[model samples]
Target chain A: MGTTGTDIRYLVIIGIAVMLLLFTSFLLALIFNQRKKLKYQQSMEKLREQQQNQLIEAAVRSEETERHRIAETLHDEVGAILSSAKLHLLGIKSDILDERDQQLHEKGRELLNEVIQKVRGISHNLHSNILKEFGLNEAIRHFIRKIAQGTVLHATTALDDNYKTENPDNDISIYRMVQELVNNILKYANATEFIVSSTHRGNELDMVIFHNGDGLTQEQFEELRYQKEGLGLKNIQNRIILLKGSIHFTSGSEGYRINIHIPVKSNQP
Target chain B: MKLINFIRDWSEVWALLIPLIIILVFKPAKKQLRPVILYVFAGFILNFLATFMVEYYYLMPSWTYTDGYVNNNILYNLHSFVRVLFLGWYIISVRQYKFPFLLKTLLIFYLVFVITNFTFYESPFILSTRLYAAESITLLVICLFYFFRSMQDESDINWLKHPSFLIAAGISLYEVITFFIFLFFYPLHQKDISFAAVTMRIYTITFVVFCILLALALYKSRKKSNLSGVTG
Candidate 1:
């Protein structure tokens, strides 16, 4: 009886200890399992993000390619035809005609000249040859000069000359973003002044735009970027995401400002 | 000596009180945690009475005695009842399961079983091993379901730090460790008092760990307003 009692005692103790050990093992297994699940979920999210970025990159690239095609066609084909038509109109002798006929001939020449200028301007705006040759800084300057030509809005640029272009594709993206922002400002913002400034520090390029106009706050930008009408903003965001950069918008009582930060990879070595 | 005895007798009370105070002090999002708070409060009150009776039952009037022995098992029985009720309520409130009606029916059936077993077959004043076994089984099954569902969840939440996970873990730990002991508690006590005492001590230690986990869950919880408001 004594031996039996002692054996029972050992069995109970062993059972309890074993159960505890099992529970501990179970908890460890649970934690490890959860960690594995978490890693899997994170990898899945990253995969989705990469796929979405690829789609956006493809879309943006195709859009740029189409714009370049249309610009080349306009410049090389339509501009040449318009210039030839103007030359043919000019070849006629206006001095040998009556006063009214000469006046009509002069008007035709003036109209043809204006039509040629308009076509050329449209082609340049669509795809800037300056952007291809002189880089982003000169192209932006040319853009500002063109927009502020006869408009009430006084625009200025304080771009850093220290910037050395390494990626032309990134330059085109930056130029397009600037163009979209300025166009949005012209369409919606009833302001009289705008400033586009750039600073190159170390490996980062910072472009800050300040305007006395109604502009979106960061929250508003985030909210609007998911909307249908915000396609342009979405494209800008896609470009920023592709460049692995950030864009911040700030609005004050006096004016609004947007800061674009991009990490520029240098090839100076 | 008296103070030492008091501490020894009321050890589980102290363990239960820690989480109760933490939950009250932290004031976790009350909308989701109301059932948990209620369970803790109910458990604290029941445990305090049960411990108090164990310590001071000799001073009580004779009418309070059952079969000439001071039996505080009914308090523990009530504690078991509320433990299942409020814990089940907390689970039901949070998750959108397929069979809520079935869960509600099961809870009702559990109450009926407790009443029938205590009234007809076994006295509540004496520790009802059957009732405890049933409670432990029900809780274990519920916790298993909770775990299975949580494993399949795809949210970006850190389950290790989540309050629901911690509460489920605490309950599961307590249930898993002490289940067989409760199932054979009477037989073991009849055969060897010393062995039963040791097992009961293990139960006490497990309860302490459970309370600490509950405290951690409460600490990790945040107010609903804090959860909703976005910071710049």
Candidate 2:
């Protein structure tokens, strides 16, 4: 029996070896399958990203077309009528020669001119040709200048010298992203100083905005990531990622800071 | 010891021959081409090695041989070592043919520790043939636990529920019963407990049970495959 035990033990050893080999093969198959599945999932995610971008682009084009139509209507129809009305009023006031009535006519003409200018300004903000002509830096300057006139924002920008040569699509996206950020900052941050700066190091570009103001809580940031519509932040993230860039936001005791970085030359394709 | 050897040799012949006979008679459920190849390589290597270890490298058991000469060949132990490893993988991968190759290979290496046992050592004290059988069955049970869990559409297997597997399981139970006897009586006298009786009781019963179940399994699988072809 002892002799038989010795023989059986050998068989058991063989059995053990067989089991080990099979299990190893199974694990290898699992890893291979997992990688393949992950690759497929990544491709699907990429397709979804492309579809969302196409939708955003279509919306932007639709809005731009609408703005152009409005701008045309104001300049051609309303602007001509206002000018004609002003000329007629001046002619009439000269004929009257009564001081009080003449003064009132002059004041009325000035008000009419102001109204016409304000209407033109609104049309330009909707979609401006100046943005396309001078590129983003000058356009942003004009934008901040106009916003500053109304609010005590003191909006200052430090765009690098090479801003003109930026990728036009990226520039447009940056402008839109910044505009959204500023709108949120104005309404919610309750800040005093708003400074926006762009820095260039080799092929890399970094844009930062600093606000000396009340900051958001950790819970608010968590909500932004998890639940809230948070279209503004989401939009910012989408644009940066599309540009193959990165965006970071930090809340400090002093205020909140946001920074965006992108590799300019290498990421062109 | 001589009687036990006779019974064990008969049991092993039955284990291999019955499976062979069933395959010749009725085909498997699935073609089972892959496992067939793997099992052949595994079984051959394991059988050869086990024979070698018992016959040679292990402290020659004071058991009777053909010419009263103890065989000692390095090839025997080496092959036996390899066989144990192969069996480890076979039983583990026996349930599902989908186990990874790396795991199978690693399992083979892992089985080496079993030979560190006293069965192959100078003195067969702690790690005896019974202990080896017990370990093999336990591991096999663990490996097939999933196979026996529930019946699925592709494979309606419930090992615990299957009487056929229970027959194979008898092999394990018998080994355990013998181990207890050995443990109780071993200290007193080696000759008093008949090695012949235990081997006859264990191997004869276990081998017959294993052969019957294997034959049944082969028949069922063959019938299934034939039905599948007709339906298709």
- The candidate that wins on DockQ is 1
Chain A TM-scores of all predicted models: 0.88, 0.79
Write down the TM-score of every candidate. Answer: 0.79, 0.51
lDDT of 2 by residue, A30-111 (tens): 3455456556667877898788767766665565578778987887778788888878876784555788877888789899
CAPRI verdict on model 1?
acceptable
Which regions of candidate 1 deviate over 4 angstroms?
A2-12, A28-40, A96-111, A160-162, A199-204, A265-269, B1-34, B48-72, B89-109, B148-163, B180-202, B215-232
Query: Tens digits of per-residue lDDT for model 1 on A55-146?
Result: 87798899988998998999899999998898888899888999999999999988988888888898998885899899999999999999
DockQ of 1: 0.29
- How far is each candidate from the true structure, as Cα RMSD in Å? 4.8, 18.8
Clashes of each: 0, 46
- Model 1 clash pairs are none
